[model samples]
Target chain A: DARVTQTPRHKVTEMGQEVTMRCQPILGHNTVFWYRQTMMQGLELLAYFRNRAPLDDSGMPKDRFSAEMPDATLATLKIQPSEPRDSAVYFCASGLVRGTGASSYNSPLHFGNGTRLTVT
Target chain B: DQQVKQNSPSLSVQEGRISILNCDYTNSMFDYFLWYKKYPAEGPTFLISISSIKDKNEDGRFTVFLNKSAKHLSLHIVPSQPGDSAVYFCAAIAYNNNDMRFGAGTRLTVKP
Candidate 1:
């Protein structure tokens, strides 16, 4: 079965370390989203890309967080000089819109298992 | 500010009973709502969804009811089972935006 795949299912890093998470969306899926989940915040959408172009990153912290979709299959979320407050499970989801052309933005997201990041 | 809220942190239901989980949204622009079930260490899975135009939508044993005027929605699971025990998150998507806002989630425990 096709599914969104994420690397480093678990990551542990000290404060001020650079953390990078990678995702491989299902083949041909046109929309990719990155979300962070924590006990305090629940699930927050950090960034989203449609057709390998970022549509929104306003939810992301501008100074340390960055997300990108280099190509159709690859999407990445990076935190430079990550802080302890950034510790959370990061999820990647992919989907294609229904009846509105080939974009995933209009469809329900299919999620990956997620990367559990713990910054000490 | 939290756009979506699931006030109850947890709920316990007996097997074969109906389980009701509620959600509230602050944004009137939210036109589509969804319920997602999550197991530990796994991503949330889509369970049911409803559009603002409809009052209710049902699929098998799962039914989602929407109250557009009240900005409220709920998920009903009939004959709750042990396998149904998991965290349920309520998500809302604005009519004009693709971003989906989620609630803090309610942990449902179905006892035998």
Candidate 2:
């Protein structure tokens, strides 16, 4: 079955280290989303891209966190100078929206097993 | 600020009974809502969804209800089974905006 695939199921890094998480969305999916889950905050949307173009990154920390869709099949979320507070499970999800219409936006997302990131 | 909120952190119901999980949102721009089920160490999976224009949607044993005036929605599972126990997340999406927001999930437990 087709599913979104994420690399490095787990990652451990120290302060000031850089961490990169990769995702391969299902073929033909047009949207990719990145989210962070923590005990206190639940699932927080960091960014999303549609048609390989970044649509929203307002939820992300611009100074340290960056998300990019290098191509249709590959999406990446990177963090530099990671901090302890950044420790959380990051999830990558993909969905197909047929058009800009309201009904098409109802498509549900398919998520990949998340990358558990622990910054010490 | 969290636009979506699942007030209850957890819920428990006996098998064969009904389990209801509620969610409330502050943003009126949201035109669609969804419920997702998540097991430990696994990604959240889509469960059910309801459009703002409709009051309810049902599929098999799962049903979703929406109250646009109250900015609230709920998921109901009839004949709750042990296998149905998991974290339920409520999410919302706005028209023309693919930025989906999620609420803190509610852990559901079904006892035999």
Candidate 3:
């Protein structure tokens, strides 16, 4: 079956280090989303892209976090000078919905296994 | 502020019994709701979803109920099995919005 693929299933980094996470969305999917899951905040949407263009990144920390969709198959979330609070599981999800208009009401997301990042 | 909330941190039930998990949302704009099951070290998997137009939706042993007036939703699993034990999350999507909000998960344990 097709699935969203993520790289570096686990990452361990020291504070102030730069961390990069990559995702390859399911083939033919046009929407990609990045999420972070932690015990305290639960699941939070950091950013999302539609048709290789970013629609929103308001949930991400503007100073240190950046998310990019360089191409249809590649999406990346990077944290420069990462902090301990950044430790969490990062998940990438893709859907067939090109937009949230009337025609895409039933579109559902398919998630990747996620990359567990631990910042010390 | 938390738009979606799952107050119960955990729940336990015996096998073959019914398990009920509740979720509440503050945003009336949220017209679509979904439930997801997650295991340790794995991503949350989509289980069931309900739209505000309908009050209830059922698939096999899983049933989801939505109360638009109260801005609440719930999931009920009948005849719970040992394999049903996992973390359950409630998610809400605003109408015509690409963003979806999620609540703190509730862990369920089904005992034999």
In model 1, how large is the Cα lDDT of residue A61? 97
TM-score rank order:
3, 2, 1
Residues B2-95 of candidate 3: C-alpha lDDT, one tens digit per residue: 8999999899999999999999999877888999999988888999998888999999999999989989899999989999999999998887
Structural similarity to truth (TM-score) of each candidate: 0.95, 0.96, 0.97
Clash total of candidate 2:
0
Fnat of all models, as shown: 0.46, 0.52, 0.51
TM-score of decoy 3: 0.97
Taking the tens digit of each residue's C-alpha lDDT, what string does model 3 give over A2-97? Answer: 989999999999999999999999888998999999887678889988899898899999999999998999999999999999999999999877
Q: List the residue pairs that clash in candidate 3.
A: none
lDDT for model 3 comes to 0.90
**What DockQ does each prediction reach against the true complex?**
0.52, 0.65, 0.61
Q: Give the top-scoring candidate (DockQ).
A: 2
For candidate 2, lDDT tens digit of each residue in B7-106? 8999999999999999999988899899999998889999998888899999999999999999999999998999999999999988777778999999
Clashes of each: 1, 0, 0
Q: Candidate 1: where are CA atoms >4 Å away?
A: A98-107
lDDT by candidate, in order shown: 0.89, 0.92, 0.90
For model 3, the DockQ equals 0.61
User: What ranges in model 3 sit over 4 Å off?
Assistant: A101-106
Name the TM-score of chain A in model 1.
0.91
